[model samples]
Target: MRTSACVLALSLAAAGPAIAQDHVHAQGAHGGLGTVVFPNSGKTAAQADFIRGVAHLHSFGYRDAAIAFRAAEKADPGFALAYWMEALTHRHPLWGQEDLPAARLALSPLGASSQARVARAKTPRERAWGGAIEALFAEGKEVDRARAFADSMRRIADSDPADLEASAFAALGLLGLGAQVGKGITADDAIRYAENVFAKNPKHPGAAHYLIHAFDNPVRAEQGLPFAREYAKIAPDAEHALHMPSHIFLQIGAWEDVVASNERAWAASRAWAKQNNLDNAVLDYHSLTWLQYAYLQQGRFRDARALIDTARTLMASGPANARYSLWDFWFQYASASGDWKSVSVADPLSVDEAPDAGAAFPLPDMVQAGVAAVSRGDSARAARILSLLKARRATAVPGSYSNNGYEMGVALIAGGIARLRGDQLGAIAFYSAGADIEAKGSPAGPPIIPPVLLPYGNLLIANRMHSEAVRAFERELLLRKNHSASLLGLARAHRAQGNPAAAMQAYRQLLENWKRADADYPPLREVKAGASSSPGIILN
Candidate 1:
């Protein structure tokens, strides 16, 4: 039994001077895979560069990986793996995104079939690699192709245990499978594969990076924190690497860490864009979105508002799709801060404002609009928003990505509308429906925009359903511990129900949690006031 570590060392030793020369030239930009040799890549400087590209690909640096692969092709036009890797770069396995046109163009120079591509390979291992990629691009449903591709990679890895790249790619395929099935087993497989690679090489970019994606939700988020903390250090230059840790941080509610990670990532993306002469650096948008969310969570309202304005300015000149994320950030910030006034600003847009407005507007925005309307005593506006949501829901495809949380959104909005109409029973019914849909949606993670449970619990408290409100707030806390809004609600519900002990406990917890929060943040001020008024809640 050849251990992965032994094989890795032997593989690096086999590459000899070419690997060192490639490392010296590439200067560790290939994500720390300078030593791992692809034996079939012809032991040349060009092949070494191709392996560097593979390392970048494993770390999710698709743009940089494509550039490196292209450079390899320029150095050696006959390198079949270079072309194959370039095509792979176009497919984001976890994001359900594929640039098929670009992939087809990349593969055009090579023959059509796997057998044809294999015939051009200079080594048996290279033939196997080409065949596996061909299986991924085979004609079928996207999920089916992904499953077939994962199977091929697993077989290849099993046959050649030294092929850490094959194992890493297989882990990515497992993530795709996990995403398709919406189950944890495939994600678990991905974690196991990544851990195996880590056991051999701790600094392996794919091992650390894929581990973050594998456990990005609430239940498993802490499991990835060790990797998350190390990933930025492992590949500091890769924008995705710097931004990836924030996924875990967000899941864990580490607002400060989230802010720091995205700040660095945003700056790096801007620098890279300037150096490369790319005007519209759309890549920075992702980090900016995360950064704004973090700033809002920290009660840095002024900072968050400034970031939103900056995002708006960027979108004016950026890609059209940038509007979707920028709008999401804006909506999330306003909702989190209880800024209902902002929500009322867009109540009059017709459904036909854009061809894809239905998908773009979705349930969360409608729910927020409806909530704002009801809060302002504008029942007519709330009703209008509800009607639009119902119409959108009626036309939505059941299992499509666009409609993943559609039912939950409808239920929450309908619930809010019922509460406004003084129908407590109807409100609870709809709110319960929303909670059920959310629970069934999959592994519980950070609260979605306009959090279903927080508002649902608030409605329950308003209706004097104290016990039910306590349960609702407790449920939200399980997903997001120490959440200020939920904690305040929990404290009030307990107080209303005459449980001073529990109320005091919750009030004390909220004060401690928000002590470092902005002094002027309404929630922090409210918590401080509550602590002062409560008999047994002493502020330390």
Candidate 2:
């Protein structure tokens, strides 16, 4: 139950020098991971810097890469490749965000169209790269553009088997394509592409980093561990590289590792912000949110509270995006700790206070407010919030999956209120609607914490609907195994249904899963104590 700052200090003291030395060794001896060369760009000091920028780009260090690319441009004003990369840094293809205006400005001097840009290229390969990126910015749907870009990069890589840089970029483009359409490049495909580059350059940052991203899900989390373990060592200065390992750790419920990884990443982000003379840093908020989540999971309430304060202070200085992180961290901490009082005291999102256009949808905050009202027996307040949520859903843009998801969250809150009012059938109907929405799957990434289905199932169990409760818990477990609450609920539901053996089995699994968790964690302590009293149950 260490504070995040203390954990970071200890982690850096124990591992920092070794990681820095590894990076030094890789780049020092024999010019390790030889310079990436574009066939058309004449070899110069500026081009060397450009190549370094490309390496950073591959590792997803867009800001740093952008800086380096700008420096390259300063060194050689006519370096079209440098300008191209500088523009590329503005777009996050996988995340579906693009600063199109910035990109267009960067490419302004080059040409107006893809063909025009290609025509300006001094060499065929340069033209190919220019044309590939042009496809990304072309007038089309993002998914279509991503597919075309991936195809173009693939052709570039196939044309020159010796250009490991091309191959690495092609792999990233494929990932972008997959992310756009939600499926295409499998983990195996990612591994294959990454390993191909690793065979030629073992210390390649992108190869290590993307390999982790490729397998950053529950089923394949362990497979990414090797890359996750090595990426920070390969690129210690990149904030994203330091943070990426936690994606795997979180999936496997390695709370301490998750805490340590994000702590280091948060420090890196702060240092970067200070060095750049920026008033705020986005990555700081990102890492802090993850760090607080780990602290909450380990039952370090005091530490988690400190993090909440820190996040609030950061939000005051940071950009609009930081508000999103602040709200997410606030909601997750309150929900996980079951501190409805805090949720009740929380301010609702006013239109003026909305972080962005997307965040103007107030269903998330209303959902929490409604839940807190129900918990506090303020049925009128809960009903008011539910009405507001329903009206919002009604006016939400049709066919928008995000809006539909919000409506589902609305259903959940309405159901909770119904349950509080003792209307069992109404509660079940609302809960069923919410569950149906979840069944359609999330359009975005997994949430920072477990889904609300656990509580919905617990409500069902309260009404003696044990079988339905068990199914709900099991469904949540499918999305995130080793979720402590879901496991405990499943166990209790089995017990309520007169299945002693199944209950005991679940209790044992919970015990095993939480063996390494903080001893003070309430769920872990509850399971341990409960198991001791269960007939024929044994604790290892």
Candidate 3:
């Protein structure tokens, strides 16, 4: 990521030349010299200079930036951007240690001014930036502050008429709200906003990332896969970006594309890590985990195992916190592999471990609920409890932990169980409702486990919409190509379509990908047997 200063400098540099063309004007301190420029032209030179100072800090000149920021603010006390810049420049340790208190104080005026601006600004960008500033403040592990920020952002977004930045900011705000609600936002809404961003500006910086989130739409895999491919092409160096949409491809049953995306993510992460000395075990884990999954999809157990070992070693030596994330990767790996014992072996949590289990917060009871549900075949009970847990999330307020995705996943599971019990309509309704909410933009967006597409694909399959199911599976593959469950869903869809050849191929692919399952593969011996036996196409 570019430093704040660098981004600011770039933005200002682009505008600076334009400013020079305007009639030069000077003002002493405050209105003592009176307003020197047209009110329609926006702030004067001194006010903008303060904002530039904030951006300068990103270039690693904090002291200089701070001095300039102070001088500019002193000259133009009512300037909102100046306060915003002051807040951003001082918020983090650009050069050394951070001064959070001072940062907050500096930005406080910006927040106030942003509110004022939002109330009166005629331009959408001005209003949107107000919301963006508030949304930025909504971060942290809690929900209250996050929700407030989200609400503010939403207000700004709703007020704007097709503003691209508003779309982005709204997505971010909604994501935060979704987290507070314990499901984040509806995946549909998130995608809509993301798409709005792309529609508004194809060259937008984070458009692909937001678009990747939209694949949660059960019917968007076909379109999403192509989008993900294009996104990867545009941002070849963004490892996380490359990996995110690949999972969707997996859901849509695009095995080849899934493998390609995983490879891209892995390659990007590896190269970036080597070049930047970034000890990002999380990024590496995501990359390698997907690779292992791809291999398993190909039924190459040995290769999957090799990748797992390497991932484990890399994570173990990377960082202490990284060790904990490894647990999730390994857990997913084991589950896919059908090795229940490995779950225990790879368990990073101990009695001595922190209460949050490395997430630095309280562990969500849903974790236990999910474990019990998955462990016991009481999917109904699991689903029910999960729904309750989600519904019970804290309200959107400052400093609360809502995590909408967490709730959505539970609801999705409930819907999945309902579908498995032959209630197709009920399942669709549940999944669809959660999907709608998850679609909104939240700070954290959706939960990784039991992703929306997981139940979505299953529901499509139960309805006997094999082609749609295939598309869903492919979409999931786009987000996580190595997701065994998605691969299995694709295989099932192929079988249901009566493509015996395709079914066999998908099943074999599932078997290969099963190797990447650190041990989570549910050990269903009859999966392939049933898949192979029904050479009959059962498309609805």
Best by lDDT: 1
lDDT per prediction? 0.70, 0.67, 0.51
Residue lDDT tens for model 1, 156-275: 676655567777888888887777766476888788778877777676778888899988876788999999998887777678888889888887777778889999999988887777
lDDT of 2 by residue, 1-540 (tens): 211110111111222221110111212211222233333343354655666677668766687678778877787676677778888898887655788878878788777776777787554566677788888888888788878888887776766555665677787887887776554344466566777776777677888877877777766778878877887777776678788888778777777788899999999888877777877645467678788777765667667777877777776675756235556766677766776565322455433232233235445566766666676777777776666666667766765654665667677677777887789888888878777666555322236323567777887898899999999988877666666667788988888887877777777777765565666665665577556654543322
Please list the residue runs of candidate 1 whose C-alpha ends up more than 4 Å from where it truly belongs after superposition.
1-38, 322-325, 342-349, 352-404, 442-449, 529-540
Instruction: Please provide TM-scores, in order, for all candidate models, with all chains considered together.
Output: 0.86, 0.81, 0.52
lDDT of 3: 0.51
TM-score of 3: 0.52
Q: Residue 420 of candidate 1: its Cα lDDT?
A: 75
Residue 32, candidate 3: alpha-carbon lDDT? 14
lDDT of 1: 0.70
lDDT of 3 by residue, 196-300 (tens): 766755544345555655553344555676566666544443455567666566655555666677787788667756665667453455556666655655555
